[model samples]
Target: MARQVSLATQLAQSPSAWNGHIAPLILRAMTDVYITLAWIFQDREKRTDEYVKYGLGQRKLWLEHFKRSLVERGEKEPEKNLFVKALTRQLNAERFEHITEVNVGAWSERSTRKMAEEAGCLDLYRLAYTPFSTAVHSMWTHIAGYNLRRCRNPLHQFHRVPEDSDLEPDIDYVYRAAKYVAKTFALFDRETGVSVETPSSLDQFVESLAHPTGEAQTDSPDPLDDL
Candidate 1:
C-alpha cells in the first residue's frame, strides 16, 4: 500500500500525469491497491499466505511463459536457458520449484469486483476498475472521445481525426491520489488502533495546499480543481 501511494505521489510530479487520461489510470491503479490491502488486512493470518502463494504462482506462470516464448522463437534446449535457470533458482530460494503451484487465474481465484465487494469498497471497483480499462484496452468509448478531434477543413465534413491533444494539468489528480493514500492509512488505523502522533506527509501536503497560510480556510476549493 505504501509502495502504491509512493507511485501515485511520483506520478503527481509529472505534468503528463495531471491530465484526465493518465491521471485516472494511475488513480485507478491506486484504488485497486487500496482494495487489495483492505481485503488482505481483513484476515491477515490466512490471507497473507494466500497472497504469497498467488504471487509465487504468478512468477512461476511468467517463467513458464518465458520458456514457451523462447521455444516458440525457435530456440532449442530452452531447458538449460541461462536466465530461466537463474530465475528458477531465485524463486526456488523462496520456495522449492516443485512446491509452488502455477495458477492461470485471478489472484484470489475470484473476480476483482467480487473482492472489492467483499472488501467494502465496491465503489472503488465501480469507479476505478472497469472504467479505466478503456484507456488500457483502447476501447471506442474512451479513445473515440479522448484521442480524436475535429478536422479544421470544411470539406472534410467535420470528421474526427485522431490526435493526442495536450490537456490542461489538473490538481484534482493530486488530491485524489492523496485521498487514496488517506483511505489506506485510515484503514490501517481503524484495524490496528495505532497511528503516528504526527500527520502523514500526504495529510500535510493536502492541508497545506488546501490552506496555504497558517490559518484555516473554510471556503470551497475551485470547482475545476475538484475535477
Candidate 2:
C-alpha cells in the first residue's frame, strides 16, 4: 500500500485533476497486484507461450499505428522513417509475420472479474474497483454522486459544477487500499525471501481512523491562558 499511501499524501499536498488520476490507477493496480500473486502461487510457466504471443501481437499493433502516422505525414517510405530503434524492426520478418497469424486480440481475454476470481480478490474488486470504474469512465453515477449538491435556500435547489475540491470519498476506501497494500507487501516478502515488516503506525493509523474523536486536542499545560 505504499502506492495508496503515496497517492493519499499527494492528494493532501496538492489536490488537482492530474493527481486525482491516482484514484483510478490505484484501483487498477490493486487488481493487477492480486492477479500477479495468483500467477506466482500457480505455475506461471504454463502460460509462457500465450504471453509471448500476446506481447508480439501488441508490438505489431503499435508498429502498425506508427506506420499509419508516418503515412499520414506523407512520408514516401515509412520503413526508413524510424528515428528510434524499435523491437519491431529488429525482429525477424518471418517471426514478425506471425503477429498476423494470432487473431485473439491485443488485450487479455480475461475480464476484471475473472482476474479477481483467480487472484482471490473478488470481494475487493466489487467493493473498490467496480465503484472506482465509474470515475474512470466518467459515468453519470459518479457525476451525480460527487458534483451534484443542493443549494442552501428555502426552495432547496440543485447545482452542478465542473469540479469540486471539497469532495472527499468515504474513508473506507482508503482503509481497503491500505489493507490491499499490506497484503501485497507481505506476499512479495514471502515470495522473494525478504524479511520486511510492516510498520506498527499503519495499524495504529487504521485504528484511529475507525474511532475518530475529531480534531486533535492541544497539549498546552495552561489551557485557559490561551483563550
Best-matching candidate per lDDT: 1
Model 2: residues with Cα > 4 Å off, grouped in runs: 1-22, 87-108, 148-177, 189-227
lDDT of 1 by residue, 4-45 (tens): 778677877897779867877787778778888888887887
lDDT (Cα, tens digit) per residue for candidate 2, span 1-227? 45545654453344333333345655556655555455445545655455566666766667777888988989877777654235455554536644444435523467767766876768767876777777777788876766565565646455554556564454544555566666676666766788856574458657677656664545524566569
Candidate 2 CA-lDDT value: 0.59
Candidate 1 vs. true structure, TM-score: 0.84
Spell out the clash pairs found in candidate 1: none
Model 1 ranges with Cα > 4 A deviation: 152-155, 211-227
**Candidate with best TM-score:** 1
- In model 2, what lDDT does residue 219 have? 55
Q: What global local distance difference test value does model 1 have?
A: 0.82
